[model samples]
Target: MLVLAVDTATPAVTAGVVRLEGDTPKTLASRITVNARAHAEVLTPHILECLTEAGVVPADLDAVVVGCGPGPFTGLRVGMATAAAFGDALGIPVHGVCSLDAIAVEAALGRDLLVVTDARRREVYWARYSGGVRVQGPEVNKPADLEPTPSQAIAGSAGHVDLFDLPVEPVETPSPAGLVAVAAAALGSGAEPAPLVPLYLRRPDAVAIADRKK
Candidate 1:
């Protein structure tokens, strides 16, 4: 099956085309631009480029996969919204996977691993994984609030990885290949696609103000 995958949960705006044969996902092409503020501007173009590089068209995709983020509100929306739009337009299922899981899926560490991504405001989005499966949080909190096991290794954005004293495995962002690979089982089992929800973890910084007392 031909699948298009995207992830914008970190500074990277990522897109790719993957061929899933049975349980394996092979990345045909991918493009990533690392800029926190360019998600809206760069995502669609990246998607198109990935498709072109993979020698496929939107109509040829059998499914779409996206990273549902525990990330900043603005950046996270771009990926999920774009994936949903493509899925709707092509009449294919859109699968949502945790942005953290994307990174976790690619981790080569042999021990427990912790995945962290910038959440801004001096905080991070984190999860604990063992054997490539998430065993704990996709939660957001200050780095100091997290307790990493003595043997745990870290994978994620550089700055956040520095927050921990552990050995950093250095994974800056989720890859499109990882995003689709992690979702392959669900897709194969015909499980319902994940809801199109942004895992902002916290409310947006901007909020409505009530009218002044009149």
Candidate 2:
């Protein structure tokens, strides 16, 4: 199956065209722009360029996958909205994969691995994975406050990795291929996808002016 995948849960704005057969996903083309502030500016163009490089058009995609993030509200919103627009226009199923899970999929770490990403606010969003399957957390807390676990190593945002004492993996963002790989089963089974929900573990910073005035 041909898939269009995108992620904007971190500083990297990522997009790709992928070919999935069974459980293996092969990326046909990918584009990444490492600009924390460019999610809205770069996502669509990155996606278009990826498709072009892969020699596929929007009509050729069988499904769309996006990272539903435990990330900043604005970044997650841009990615999810763009992906939904594509799925709706093409009449294809849009699958929402956990951004952390996507990072874990590519890490191939052990039962003692943890995944984390910069959640801003002097904190991080984290989850513990047992051989790539999440077993704990998508929770946010300061590095010092995170409950001590048996985590042996960590993989995620490069900026935040050094905050913890574990060995680090090179992955810094959820790649488009990793996003699709997390949804491979649903795509192959032709299951109805769940609705897109941004995993903003906390409320957004923006509030109505009336509320702010109190």
Candidate 3:
């Protein structure tokens, strides 16, 4: 099966094409850009480039996998919208995986992991993984504000762990490969992609004009 996966939940704009056979997934093409603002522009081109490089078109894909992020509202929507649009056009299945889980899956050993992404404003979007599944949360806050719990490994930006000592090595950011794995499982399970939903764990930075007037 051919799958297209994308993630724009953090500073990076990531997209990839994977060919899945039996129980494994192989990367045919992929790209990761760490610029926050380019997500809107880079996402579609990356998808097209990935498909072309893989020598497969959208119609050839069996499904689409997307990172449903607990990320900033604006940037997170770009990836989700793109994935949903492609799925709609191709009439194929699209599945959403936690972006943090995708990052955790990228680490060594596939053990229980705490994944975090910088959310700016001195906070982050975080989650915990266990046995290749999300076991704790997809929450938003400073790492120091998070519950102090033990983990087998850590993923996402290393800055997240600066406030606490952990049992495992810290991995910075979710890799394209990890995002693909999570998406693949969702597809394999016959999960349906809902309307593109931004997993914003917190409110937007902009206050409403009405509220500001108060």
Q: Which one wins on TM-score?
A: 2
**Residue 153's lDDT in candidate 2:** 84
Q: Can you give the lDDT of residue 23 in candidate 2?
A: 90
- True-vs-predicted CA distance for residue 7, candidate 3, Å: 0.4
lDDT of 2 at 3: 95
Stretches of candidate 3 above 4 Å error? Answer: 108-111, 167-170, 189-191, 207-214
- Once model 3 is optimally superposed onto the true structure by TM-score, how far is the C-alpha of residue 103 displaced, in angstroms? 1.1
Q: Please give the range of 10 consecutive residues that has the lowest summed lDDT in model 2.
A: 146-155
- What is the lDDT for 203 in model 1? 84
lDDT of 3: 0.79
RMSD of 2: 1.1
> Each candidate's TM vs. the true structure?
0.95, 0.97, 0.88
Q: Rate the local accuracy (lDDT) of all candidates.
A: 0.89, 0.90, 0.79
Clash counts per candidate, in order, are 0, 0, 2
Pairs of residues clashing in candidate 3: 156-172, 156-173
Question: Residue by residue across 1-214, what tens digits does model 3's lDDT show?
Answer: 8888898888889899988775577889998888888999999999999989999888899988888888888889899899889988999988877888777766755556677788889987877777777778888787678865667656677666655565545556555567667766556777665655678877788878998899
Query: Higher-TM-score candidate among 2 and 3?
Result: 2
